[model samples]
Target: MSQNNDNSVLFGNGDELPSNASDNPHINQLIDGVGRRQVLAAGAALGTLAFLGSVMPGAAVAAEPAAKGLEKLHFRPRSKLPFTAIATNRLDSISVPTGYRATPFIPWGTPITGNYPAYLSDGSNSAQDQAEQLGMHHDGMHFFPIDAQRGGKKSDHGLLVLNHEYIDAPLLHPNGPTLVAGKRSSAEEVRKEINAHGVSVVEVRRGLNGEWAVLPSARNRRITGATPMQISGPARGHALLKTRYSPKGTATRGTLNNCSHGFTPWGTYLTCEENWAGYFASRDTDLPRELSRYGLRSSSRYGWDHLKGDEFERFDATRTTTTASADYRNEPNHFGWIVEIDPFAPESVPVKRTALGRFAHEGLVFAPVKSGRPVVCYSGDDSQNEYIYKYVSRDKYRPGRSNGRLLDEGTLYVARFDASGKGEWLALDIYDKKFQQACKAAGVSFADQGEVLINTRLAADVVGATKMDRPEWGAVNPDNGEVYFTLTNNSARTSVDAANPRPANAFGHIIRWRELCKDYAGRQFAWSLFMLAGPEADSIGPNGKPLTADNRLASPDGLWFDEEGRLWIQTDMSGSQLSSGPFGNNQMLVAEPRTGELKRFLVGPVGAEVTGITATPDFRTLFVNIQHPGEGSTATNLLSTWPDGPGQRPRSATVIITREDGRRLL
Candidate 1:
């Protein structure tokens, strides 16, 4: 998972909840019934679940519901396993239900061209070889079926689009690149790194015996940072995006820091750009004015500025000269937007849809479309105390078949949570009075819609939207028409408020809302706290309110709902305090939304983030990505010996999880 923005501050210090409590009746009602009761029962249940040593890990067994609303597990022996027990010492094995098995499908740098040799991990691969091989740091992913006639067949194959985030330079380059007095050792080295940072589309199929493998077809394609992409929607051709490669400011050459993703209803891959800000650096003295606009407070931590070339120099947004044409002021503007790719059409140019307001986009979930009505999209800003936003396409989604052009136009709105439990979707338009006033106050002039979309964060702040704890992935419950977003933990969120009132939010919570009259494009909605993270003891009702064990989870990150309406929740935690101490490591949990029944399904090893979950229609097989294991440790002195072996270092890989009995995960 990606870190939130830098502006957020902790609400209160220590573990205690904030003292300035709300007098609202709804808060009191929640505290009285559901909150208090659930906490108590969850506390007792956690103790029992942790202490029940008889239930061996991976055994399928149903768990007795300590509270109502939570359904009993169908597999008694398997469901009883504690959430923490899923972590394993084995390098290439998955800890799943007893009957299940996990196969490592595509490891980092796997050959895709059928010509490149397997990854040796010694940094000897060439730029061409790396391009033909799988990119490093695999994050959000989705599996698309090639044949609709197969009826969700596991035996059928499809295309897999996986985001290749930043590369491990130290691991990828031999003896590390030799910086010649702050310049890159060679231009080829820069080329290699750029070519290694994007998305990979590989053809995959299942064998007759039900085994899944990559199909080395001619359609296999690798899109890297050098790949040309078009700018679309409101921000296309904006002056802010002007670059030598894209002099018209309507096109750019890549996506970086791709994180959690979403699949479009029209069958396109949505790859979010996270932590792209760290790739560039602007000198404090050289371009002070330009640096401020692009959010570059100082030189970047990654030090791409020292590369001494236009390709590397574009990362530096600082402008030494007064004119934008003379410097790279517009470079940063080209990035930080949701990039869409049609994996099926390898030749199609990827598009950066500006209709979706730009920021640190984490994920984009689409609501089921209604003909003649606008299509809705939910996205999280992925920063501490940042905001959650939605976009409603002006064009209606035509039924029967996808036209693929509907996404080109839309109105993006940021969310505002009111104390009355109502929420509003604030439109982000340059012409809006709120936005105009804000721009005037900031002493900035916008030429058109493009500027507003490019500078969306500033526009949203002017409207006073509710800030949340690093909102990440979002999922819509088809059964209830409720939208659920993961409020990944915020070290800065210390005090309670109407939206996020809790102090010291170690384990974050989930916020769910029902659109007015089930209209995805509606601006008004009713909202409620769906689940609270922390120890089970902390999430309970005061008196008669209903509660369930499923509500108690920590730092909710990746979220998805299977076809059966089973909600899968994944956790992401950082800092030694959260990762090592009381909270073990990140894990994946499963929940049934209607019943409010949730259970710990699986967990990742130390230093790994549980992310990118997708399932076949049958739910018999699942795919999850383990990202950046042992990431926090220094390369010289590692903290975790994961995927263990001599000379073995943590590498992000996708795990294929399936039930041993070939049963569904629910």
Candidate 2:
């Protein structure tokens, strides 16, 4: 059943009290505050009521100027500030602000070294060529400073680790691959596709007067689908991960569908894997007994199985044979986790830390870690009706400069929201008797923690975690320590319980939570509906106060906070939706969370999904990506003529946004 078709039940009235009030006196105090305010007010006031205005907490009070065009953020800004839209159809390019300039920092198939030539884009790029060159479909990225000791200053150079989600076959191959009965071209072609499916690490530096470019330094590296990466935590070496590449089952070769990303406190890069299941193609007739165990009931979408003689056949997870020991039953277990890369240490191997649990991981955000307390990381599964998760390190963090060893050991928990406005983090541990009983009762087989992490969806389902709309990127409010996450609309999610109840969620909403005692690792927390995304008229709170337009956004995907604690939100919508005129196109927004002061900061051309937002420490310069502009168009039919080229197909490119007057983005 599609997620939208599910039943909708009001979770509870928004004014309900805490579910466990007896044990928590804070609830009583909050309840009293609500009662006292009601007695004083007597009735709901409509126009510009200060009491309704204060409901959003830290929202800014000052009205923001409408976006006539790009303007400065009014704070200390970066000089040489300029903004430009990169032009492209086939080959992607970078766009910069007016005075500022941008060049090709890196491009697909640009060789790192060895005998590989630059990419021909005609399917001639080899596995070795792919290993040395940048991967296809560059998405979420971060610029890690070479020297953090410099403190909040832009580095002349740094390491850039970018994700290559998936390859567009028509663009990669000259005449398209030779498909035979819904299979791929050749073994060589299949190999090239595999090698192009991971993270690309390149050293980049700003030249004299702040021109950013890639440097062919020794630290440049590429981790592909065949690159050896260790699997850590409970799910390592389980029966599911054993592939022909690693029969011992201790490691997997690479990561795929890397969408959004995060940065660890110790300076490592975190790449998330999303929508990976579509790449493989298996036959329905070959269904194995273990097929349902790994969510592969349908044929593979990519047609990789048609390759005459290639290991791509392993994409078929359905067991044609009765026994799990035959063929490649364990191949599906390698993906859907947060992979960490140490950009500072080029020689370091990427590790899949399984303690974070597994699903369609979108991004990971670290909560502020106190010296004597456990560190916490928040993550979201990007599929409709999926769950939000947190991983708290079992060991406490030490203040002095330490590598990210704390991340290697942690307990993963999924959220369960109660009707009374409080929530609990349900632990997912194979060692726990409760977990074992739950797993058995659900008729799923799990032998250890490794198995639990491998099948986290099953475990979460058994535990009754709150299923949400498509949960996308998240950002923590630096000023107030509240966790804010975007629930992108779920076309399939129509069921409304307490948390998610709307059908055809045209635009979605942002949900926020504050931990008790301000502890990031706390298992229990308090939460509230931050803001609903739609027209301003639709955002009425329970108290009959109108929510500000800044708090009303649709399909929020990428979210980040600048150095000065300003929140940036980016949107993504399909082509048909854009053409209808209800919305212009995907755009970027800036908001002061405390006051619900939000405004459209920038808008992209047609057919683009605005994504991948990050800012320099000074908040003067911002980088955003325009993905798949004119995305639904084919060679035979075209819609948008963006980045302006001669009969060129639109290509996704990164844009640098800066103020014309040289002011910060706050």
Candidate 3:
């Protein structure tokens, strides 16, 4: 769903309180003194010779001497970015540089599993058909090479796994959602919509003629809102997770609102649940802190609860028989987690790793894994003024021997960015005495570690984690182990801090940090703002100048780093901001981290947010997803007919972009 939509449902109404506690002192002094020090230090070398080639128009920045930590890492020679930056436009189509070719593939209704049903053009496909076809609104994805030994050169065949975030009900049905007396009436329509929200695993191969096609294989599968899954890790078998479907609290029925994703070294997919609270609602006067803290409302987004039967009634999430196991009140606790799926094992059930804590997980990114160190990862809660988190496994990673069990036993920590340009990872573990005292003083109570993780937001709040500006997607630099997270716009922010300096920030920014001594599991780190996203007027680039036409962007969302450490950033501007601002339709840009240069790589159609990026190992085939084109428009006042132009309805699809010369994309 667009961030600018009526999000009161996703985040509760005005009566709902903010996640961060009012007494937390961490917010009052984020970057106040530190930013001035860094700016003055950089100005000292402003007259030095330019070390990196100038890529921006009439722009050049002098190089500064290497500092401690990541700056001391060996720098490798990198080839200059090859293509010219494209101009921003509001056209309803994909745009790329002059030497690139883009082809749409695996759009919304393309069948890949089961009986291989064909997509019905008039939106007449049944709910069963949708279960067999590609789900809607593709987001975070990864391409796993079939030829494992080939390493970074295998690009011919692989498994493509992508997320189906949410559905636009009006576009999924023949005319619109069926309504009987102002409530959803068609069970098939609701079922079809539910079937469309999950992940799609398809086997794709590059043909001999330089084209790509979905190949029928046993690896292709669909995990929808109805797919059964096991709840693993700390919160497993907890009373808060007990439901009629899983009386033991060891399992759940489905995964929903999967936005961004991650992949484990042991070869598993981690699909994150974001904005899932809006799907379930309650008619009760009071709701559990687990649901209420995560923004549960009295009304639902799609009204899935309006239907009868256990399958549909679970969405209500209200107390019926007083016992948690007898009703679906614990249903909300089953979501807001990182679910692990074995893509190669088609029949294996997905597991929700609760040790990673619960919140509106935008995505998860792992640090460069080492043979003997703990498996470490970072995640961001994608909401206004939420907190960023890191999870460090208690078990050591033993190369091929490592598995999702490493995630099952871990210590989750919330970030606390201080005013001295450094940060600390505050443990949310129940055993931590500091955290225990903080909870006691705040009048919050937790019975065990599982409760601490299940109520992670409240735990972070009492311990004074720094509230950020809508942290979204995160990426780690492969060369130096520096972590970068995009803080998407937060217009609700009324106070300025070091990490989030702009009050009522409309254009979000990127913040990066290098772990102390390059230890991925270490608690201390140094951080700084990488880029402030906006028009040339108010934004700040890494070079300390305003954004130029070549790379103007806002609402930075999806982020990833290629094999060479080149950062690729995607934008997600919504509502009137997407079309009317200096920014055009959402775009994907490639950034040279060393030179602080950004070039627009691709742009999507009107009303679509360009997200979910992954590249072939050979760096030749780049797959990007364009989600929800013509989002708010209906059949009569159509706004876009993209990928299948002119007369057809707009369908979200993955565009495969390759260099015209059939060479490396960079």
Candidate 4:
């Protein structure tokens, strides 16, 4: 069964409400700070596919005179996709094109630096052993090119950094989480699960035999839930962030639910915290609106809190202490930010740059930087009817090893897409009178700028940002710099609108926007749907004929654009598609940005998602992650064991897909 994103069910009373802007607040601020009306005006929604006629054009960006051909930047003609499309299938193993070969590499439990025991078929690895092994549920990733001269040339020898989204306890341990008479039975077991919830930086090399292998290097390290991270940017040093361990609010321990990733132009890796709120439990009856909005008040996603000891107890975010710095009540505040790590410098500590603004960050992809231009990164809040965001740096970018200065001192903007094919980037700044008035009207309590950054969702709501389906991974077209994001299926979508026309959006769609005048930091953007994911029988081109086999995909999740302008899209399916269906297994396909021609490049094994893709700058070698085969399986009944035969535990892994003839992909 493909996973359904339904947030209409109430979180309490067994029927949960997805934290949406359900209430209206009267604010005496300008629309987009234009000093017009204080009453929030609802942006019109795209009511039908007719809005797509001007899909790629920035029809609403105020007409500014431009250089010759600058007007055509947003009107680039679509090109033909160059790969042969593979038929969808329900095969238990991976499938690829005729000329391509897939080799599984660096699977979960592959020891990096420890004298750890080999993984046993019976799932009996000790918690201490798992600390040194690769974590589970690999998601978004990036390949940092190892330039010997450090001049940024593409190299096959580089660090392969990946986000271990979460752990599947049932598949990892002998039995599911050990419960003793309704409470967590073993503290050691809980420790092991915590150890498996962060990011991994592995050294990958292309051997003489034309294969990629996990090589041991000084940088080969695992950052588990127990690792300490520094808190930097606007939200740092705030009183609300104070906890027993980091009383100053300048530090925290570990990164959780790391989903997608970004590679900084200054040579650092960004592992995003997506869906991280569920890990901690909040017990405060009079919880702050931000905490309640994030849904941490619900029962812990995992019962890590039930275990004895502060090490585990800190995960319970309830304000049990009369004063700050006595417990982990603020633990949830430290997470859900874009965590920055220097993969090249193994000794350096990871930093959570709070200027990015916290929410459920999907992937953070930066627009290509030019000299003296403020660096910009685009991201999406991954929840039903949430919002998309972008962080524009205060300082222009400098090319060199990461000094850790760019992400700090930045303004975060929430997108408000207009139904008439235009969008405005609403700045989430207190200096903006509208933002201040909305905060006052919404009753959001924040002592300072740091508090506002910590509680970004509240700020977004106050700004009246556009609601969207589950926005997943994002990609920026290197050719035209158009920002693209995947709106993964939202089963709760009960009404049709311009952006999401399908009432029940089971088949996800991709949307793109051209920033006005091709400026990466432009506030005005022209937006439109790029393509809708669905079955071949229903798929069609603009001409209304059946789309090619390449376009017959559902639920776009992982996305990337090769250096040569080829867009590589990966699929994620849940519920029914896991076993048998039109889109049998999750897959990765290559497509043309303009022509919208799509062709299936590869399909994952049964019961797994195709995610975490990157490639050599030359595009000769493409790396992809096949995550959670036998994903929802149980200890007693295994559905489909993969990356190993049946009777062996299924393991998530990174696979290297290369052309067999030792040439760049044709």
Candidate 5:
């Protein structure tokens, strides 16, 4: 997600605190360190600073000479994009290339499970009705094939798992939230909103006409904000997680603010919790580091605590009672962790894997698995001036034998990029000498591993981890094991570094790295800038030239790599900037990683962010999400009435794109 009015204030440590020298390394220093060799190898490597003029140690080097403009770089085969690059537009509907067909499907409030309740056009559906229907504001998603033994590529019939990031209260209701004397009055309204957050799993089948439809199956399920979930890993029984609902601290109720998502090798879905701190309110003057560093406000975002009952009162995380389990002070602690769900098994309870470390997780992407190697994955903290993290399992991955437990016993490391185009992954372990010394020097202490994982941000701060500009979604290249991540714009960034080069970076950039010695769990890595996203005049392309009309973009948010190794980039430009920004509306673009060439694939409707992308195993069908269309408008003054045309409310939806002829989507 991009920084906006609703979430920007909740992001901690933007410009409020000065950047320490250790946390902000100079970009010039890194550039100067490699300037001499880079100039000499300009012809060998693609003559662009975007590649840093260096290839990975074991990567295949291109022998052919480089070309100019949109021409192929000879680093990879010249496979042309199937469709023509679409032009930028501010249309109130989805726009695609000439030969592609984009169909809106599975929109918000679509019923697929349980009793299959029908959707009411007037937004008068009951809370129970919403519990059985699709949730609002779709984000990250994945498709699981029904036939598991078909090499996991049975795309004709599959189960779709998606995350409901947050709710638009004004659109969720007929006349907006009801409040009496500045307090939420209708408990049903609040319940409906709660049911609108979390994950949704439903079976879908492709018909003879090439359209997808939701099917009625027992595996279809909805995990909402009020559902029961288990807290697993080292922090499961910690004192900080003890709440009134779960006195043993082994469980928590639901997941909120689920933004981006991931999938495990053993076929499970991972939904990340982002911007959840603002959902809770604490009235206490003296706040702990967990709450203070996360920027919890005095009032909740949706005023859920204004009502009665334990479910509603838990939103107010103030220490009203003495005992830990007497009040809901620890309610806020239960969130901000990755929640894993089995979309194939509807009856299985979701588990919050805490060993990955607690913070505002954007998403996680696993490295290519080897039989004898440990499971390694990367995640980013989606907040201003935060740090990126990596998790390495203690046990080796045994293919079918490995499960979520592989994530339970592992080390969580924060990244520190240096000025020499090199980076280090500092472990947040209580036993590491570097961590111990840094914590003592910074006057910080932790009781055990649980505390260390719970206070991950503080631990990274003590170890002097590099401050990043709002790291969001991450993807790993299939051709090479290099990891790439999107550093969304940070307007409040007062410090500049090699990784985060621009101060007050409004147009974000993409960064990639290859682990040293080809070991993902290794501490060291080589880093480089992929591309700087912005207007044509302000942005730099992959070939070290100004970006053209086909490739210029801003605030790159969601990122993914397909089976064929093409990188898919999605944007989440804020509503306030859409009018004045050169980029028309939020869009999705395809990039040739080796060549640094990009082309606009699709453009979304007004006030919507193009995010949460996936593709069928055969690459013939592609699924993309359009979130919050016509956002920032009130009920009285509707800004967008898309998908349903002139008289209906704008709905966040998933779009299916296919080729005009029955062929692969590439």
Candidate 6:
């Protein structure tokens, strides 16, 4: 589910066996300060840290309260979630609670714009046609309600924008991918795959019969790998991003492997780029330091570079000529940033906002906004032993006045888990004294702020940020703005810390924290584990049992909080959990934050990962994505027959869940 969501991000690398990620000795390179910090956090880190940490996100540090910080947190409780718990099953169909019904909507190949050709579903759609339709492997999404007009907050009808993270080639084409001698056979196949990797925004409206349907509207648009993007923030004009196509180093084409998402206070879609490095190939006898750290290799994960033509050549970053624009060597640098797209202004070029400090970003969540206060966003670099990050905007956020401008300038910080239950946000800024000293010792000097951003992972290391166990999706509680993240397991960890209590953590746990007294942007915060996920049988010891009425889910990936203050978690079972574990299939569950009561809400079909959740503003209609059904299937030996009968193609789809009586969900 969320396991293979993105190739694990690495400050250093070692992966579960059979994975293509290369092992690197960089793990030993971590500054003693950070490693010792993690071990300390593991032991004493239990409740809110009893020290100075963060300043309020909106308030100045000097204005911080003199009293207890996070201990002062008092979140209001909401009503318990509705619906009976669903049991995990190996069945080949979407299962919902007893009173609910599910229906597929705007799945891959569905046309969102009027001029796009209707999906033939027979794999006959051309590259251009697929470009105009929804991309493949639906992931994280959000429903922006059109309140009668663009900035309006109308709940019943709105634009449903979702991410297509990856594609299922065999099902996308007539039979399977065309190959000649193990290389691509047609340029169109490569183009179609490219078109299938991006974001889609489509209008949906409730009919007179009270059913939701895709409505052709001007706002409906598709942003595929072909969409041109503008690079902004500190890393905009860096040499690492310079290419012949955008010599100024400010623009590039398309986005790749958009896994999770976020919504800004200004009404724009924040599409996160995960695992973009795998798309390019570099045959260099030696690799660029940053490129190598991100996992760019001599061969691509999918051999798109092997296709024959200049159109397909961009997929290969290997330097072919001596000149600057001759190849795509700098192409990979343009990716891996948090891309901002204005769904309302469909024609606007999406921007890759660099202030966020990119990594294999899984998902992003913003803290509650206040006028005259700086905005704060939390993101997880979904990789094994990578770090969690945050960005504090330079300017105060004005509700209606701020759209995308608030993202242009900010300070990026990596988290350090203090063993005492408290944590610190280590500034990765080039000017940070300790970080500067670390870089100096390594014989490096900051050429500019851009250099710090281009090599964000290295900067985090120099500053000593704590390594985590594959941090996935994160959420800011609506009830109190408490930040919560899913550390989705790390079997590669030969050692364990208090933050990661389990040895070779196969099943992950949910960690949450309170920003100092009302200071959502404050550097210091108090944190605690909300739930430790594992099979019910393994819920023994001080690790405590899975939450009462446990779901026993693994790799918690996608997470969202409904208007009712209910937190919904989506599970991702990678490798063995797909079949060998008691977690029968990927699932989605509902949790009561105040009580830690979790219930299994729905389970996906065989080989399908249940992800990308969003409910309409009214909370009556809920949407969930079924990704890679029959995934890892071969042309001759398929793994599943889901959403379709036996022998038919299994397409990843978005399905809507609603109560039979049309009452509110949760």
Q: Provide C-alpha RMSD values for all models, in order.
A: 8.2, 9.0, 4.3, 5.8, 4.4, 5.5
Worst 10 residues of 5 by lDDT: 10-19
lDDT scores of the candidates, listed in order:
0.66, 0.61, 0.82, 0.74, 0.81, 0.73
Q: What CA RMSD would candidate 6 show?
A: 5.5
- Distance from true location, Cα of 591 in model 6, Å: 1.1
Quick one: how many clashes does candidate 5 have? 0
lDDT of 5 by residue, 83-125 (tens): 6899888999999988899999899999978789988867888
Assess every candidate by TM-score: 0.83, 0.80, 0.94, 0.90, 0.93, 0.89
The global Cα lDDT (0 to 1) of model 4 is 0.74
On TM-score, the candidate that comes out on top is 3
The candidates, ranked best first by TM-score, are 3, 5, 4, 6, 1, 2
Residues 1-666, candidate 2, lDDT per residue (tens digit)? 001121121111011111111111111122322321221121223111112113322222112221111122334332221223322112223333245433223556666645546766345666678778877666788877666435536655567677776665554555545576554556776677777778877776656555566677777888777677888777777777776566767776678778888888777899987766555434556543223433453545446655543256566654456544454566667777789888767789899887787778889998876677788889988776677899888888776665566776778888876545567888887776776787677676666778778777767877667777777888886655667788877654333443453555667766666665445676777565555566556553322344443333467788887755567777776634556634456766666554445555566666666778765666555667666566544444445445545465555556666555546643
Cα lDDT tens digits, model 6, 121-177, are 568889899988888889889888876235655767888999988776776777767
lDDT for 161 in candidate 4 is: 90
Worst 10 residues of 3 by lDDT: 49-58
Residue 127 lDDT in model 4?
86
Candidate 2 off by > 4 Å = 1-128, 149-152, 281-294, 308-311, 318-326, 399-405, 433-445, 536-553, 633-644, 661-663
Give me the runs in candidate 4 sitting further than 4 Å from their true place.
Answer: 1-17, 23-80, 440-445, 537-550
In model 3, residue pairs whose N, Cα or C atoms come closer than 3 Å (at least 3 residues apart or on different chains), thus clashing, are 30-498, 31-498
